[model samples]
Target: MNQAVPAPTVSPLRPTDTRSTAPTRMPWLSLAILAAMGFILVAAETMPAGLLPVIAADLQTSEGVVGQFISVWALGTVVVTIPALALTRGFRRKPLILTAILGLIVANSVTAMSGDVVTALVSRFFAGAFTGVVWGMLAAYGRRISPPARGGLALSIVSIGAPAGFALGTPLGATLGTAFDWRWAFIGLTLLAIIVFALIAFVVSDAPGQAASARLPLRRVFLLPGVAIVLAVILVWMLAHNTIYTYIAPYLRATGTGIGPDLLLLVYGLASIGGIGITAVLIDRVPRGLLHGSVALFVIAGTVLLLAHSSAPAVIAAAAVWGLTFGGASAQLQSALTLAGREHSDVANSFLPVAFNLAIFAAGILGAVLLQSADGLVLPIVMIALGAVAFTLTIVGRRTAFLPRR
Candidate 1:
């Protein structure tokens, strides 16, 4: 096996840290701040799903039209992430991150103040544009600042925000909107962003950006061994995951189980939290095995759903399995790319969110088409097929992508 490439030397921003490139202890305080940033971004992006009815009514629009806010945000991310990362590659990490958080705050604030759908949708676009910058850099940033030996743990800690946002943040935003007003959710997100900005400015350690001479071109980064394969898995896996997720309500309604989409998502989200926890503990020990097991279990879960859609207990059980499989995916994929991209990890990581949002965009269209043309039960069948393909890619990528850590 080829040896892992060494990370590029990062110039420490502080005077006392010049003696060693790596920190002696895990940077919990710094990791937590980054996690907070992730939480805010994910929460801000998905909050609209939970408040769609109210937002639609307030804007005098249909729920379908209001739903486009999420899609537009994703489109903005998909369109901007690669170019934004390339353009800002030379900027210092701390300031760049702070700027992204500030953009989110402003965007969310504007969204909250907007009385018209056009204005709200425009704000969502900017929110997603800024989010592209954030997610593109965040995992790499987490890795850059942590103890060298515990990189996986740092990633897991930072990544908790995503699942937590999906599980806790979105639901809480819904509750707040239901109890008060939909605008309040955006207002609340703005407040949280403010606090995160302050924390990141004060608490997080700064890492220097890639030197111009050391930076890899975007094309080179994409072609790097394992980078493309990892991204392929992400695209396929997430496309399957999001298709069912986006249309989960209609899918559940078709199962004849009388389960509410809200309850099902709650079940999935809580289970996702557990999955990430397990990934953190086992990632370093069995990275390849963990990835294989997660995807394999996902296929099994899909099979159960396909066969037993009418059984409420079986449906809920499968959802939990699905969540568990998906929860650790971000960390696993990012870690693989970090390894694959090596010195060019940050540039490579930029593609991560692009692949994700593309899947999201495609899922929206695909789910709609499927619902129009076929039965909702076909959704699980798609999941099974895609899950199998994702697993196959992982196996085929063993040499390049999921190589055993040195």
Candidate 2:
């Protein structure tokens, strides 16, 4: 019998090796630092919304015109997310993240220095473009760095940063804008962005090499049946939520509510935090269908407030409920998208922000139009219709379970 040739010994470091030995666990300090970076980035992006009225007054423009700043920022993100993902595919994570942070730094700095509405809008557009890249990379990095079992939790932690930013940034921006000027808010954001840039640059590293075949396939992402339905849910939900949120200050003033803008921001922010916390607990335990059903209750509550706009307390309470449910729905929808495109999680994840921003743009335009139309009655009605759409889609989508069994 011919002697069998001894198999060549394979080096563990070989590119063909499929097994990942284990990623060296970073200290919690590093994780916290990364999370803080995420917080600052998101805060800078959203802080303008809270300061919109102040900016509008200073710039001598209508609130509706000021609202376009938000739409433009979101539109930038909507247009950039996918292309950014593709461009950065082969790039190292650390450098790309650093570049994004730097972009925020520049964007915020420019926004703070802007002398007119046009310059501010341009700065915001650039800020959102960078934000899109940061968000896409952050999600992809979160999944890569985490162990399989902890992936959802890791993403959740990352997701929480955005809402946390929203929660904190709004009140902070409003208070600062009230005390000083709107430009100061952007200045504060610029300083924060610089700090986050330094932290990320110093702490994080590139992810381990992935299998070449494991790269996200856009074709597969589009082919998933649940993608479009889930996108619709996200679009409608965001449109409804932002329709109210975008003009909340004006709405309160119109209703003759004594609650100041700062107070409203505080209430909305806190409610959002509560919602996020509750959803974090329920997402894994409760079925998606039921979780969405529960969120629908808050939408109804919001509708009730719109109808019964007489009581200040009731309206505030409804806003709180809306914040809670809206926050939870956002998280659930993101998780759903991730599950829907298990094979192309990054590509699917990219769509969430894209859909979210696009919806925001649509909502702002429509809300502005409604506000200009017959005595804002159309606003509430449109919100109710959006809530109905969300509820109906959740029910219809529930029948087809596309997500993998946990």
Candidate 3:
């Protein structure tokens, strides 16, 4: 019993154009700017992880306390994203985006100058609150500004920033911390945010917000046919990923493989980039097929990790496979949600960060419990179990949620 929803009304990016305002050309430059925004947000959120020792020493806190920076930020996003989006549904998209980026610049700058852990943690929480706005809008913005047919490609292009952030951003923070001071890492993120701010303001096309009559209630968006299913998949799949990923160093240490976590993450990150490329090429054509294949490959990769814990080469190979499985996940899931929610995509999209952050928080708890009570090998076993659930959900949603383009 799905109600008919109008195709998104593409308002003119500029104020001068008065006729039908849909863009005839692809906004690649704008898409890149949005991608850069994603890049800085993720890098800023994760950079602290790479600078734990230096940050803790400078703030005169323990490394264990500094580690909570990531968790606190995730909690902030979970707390604010949905409510923020619900309240601001009618604001112009570009201003909301710019304001969020500015918030990041301020948050990072504050973190760079803070002398104590309390001040720094407050800044990180605000940074995550801003992230809630930016991430919630990125996919919907990509779709609204692109040709309807090219939405998937635009999403893939924009989403490249996330995996790229994980691959390059964290390492960049580490490099800056090592070369200069840990404060330089936050300063570096602030600099990147400033550059992204200018690019978005001048180059990115602006889109109008939904009219009051057209806006859907947040609860209505939540109950939309495919929205809940997609959110469920994000939760389970990411729970599985973070469970293993958060404890990757411990797990690798147990494996007797001499391979370090940094090297393993690098391999995975590069493979994730490759995965994004593959999705860009094929997502528009075969989303269901591509998703199915990647998830299946992911399950196989988990199996490999389970069986070859002692072989460095096998573990490395499995990391590559896992990276590929994850690289395009943001694009794929966001696209599915958009298709299902149609005109209500913005509210629906906001659920993504909520589900994602909750998964990270849950994974931390789940992984900690297992590590304390059982063997490290149990982490992968949990991954395999959750991945199987994700695979089944995708199968169930094939007709309703992951439907191929006509």
**Quick one: best lDDT, which candidate?**
1
Would you list the C-alpha lDDT of every candidate in the order shown? 0.82, 0.72, 0.79
Residue-by-residue lDDT tens digits, candidate 3, 1-406: 9999987665332222222367778999999988888888777776665566577788888654676677677777888888877766666788888888888788878888998889888988888888888877777788779887777678767877877886677766766785699888888788878988998889988876656777778888889888999999899998888777766655777888987656776787788888888877888799898888888888888898989999999999999999998888877887788778887766787788899878876776677677777666887888899999999999998877888662
The best-first sequence of candidates by lDDT reads 1, 3, 2
TM-score of each: 0.86, 0.89, 0.85
lDDT of each residue in 1-406, candidate 1, tens digit only: 8999997675342222323377778889899888888888777877776665677788998655666677778888998888878777666678888888888888889999998999988998998999998887888788778887777678778877876776667767777886799989889989988988988888888775656677777998899999999999999998878777766656776899998665777788888888888888878788999999999999999999889999999999999999888888887887788789887776787798899888877776677677777777988988999999999999999999997662
Better of 1 and 2 by TM-score: 2
Model 3 off-target regions past 4 Å?
1-20, 48-67, 113-116, 146-153, 174-182, 372-377, 404-406
Evaluated with TM-score, which candidate comes out highest? 2
Considering TM-score, where higher is better, how would the candidates rank from best to worst?
2, 1, 3
In model 2, how large is the Cα lDDT of residue 265? 71
Judge candidate 1 at residue 102 and give its lDDT: 86
Off by over 4 Å in 2: 1-21, 24-27, 208-211, 401-406
Q: Which segments of model 1 are wrong by more than 4 Å?
A: 1-25, 51-64, 144-153, 178-180, 374-376, 404-406
Candidate 2 differs from the real structure by a C-alpha RMSD in angstroms, to one decimal, of: 5.4
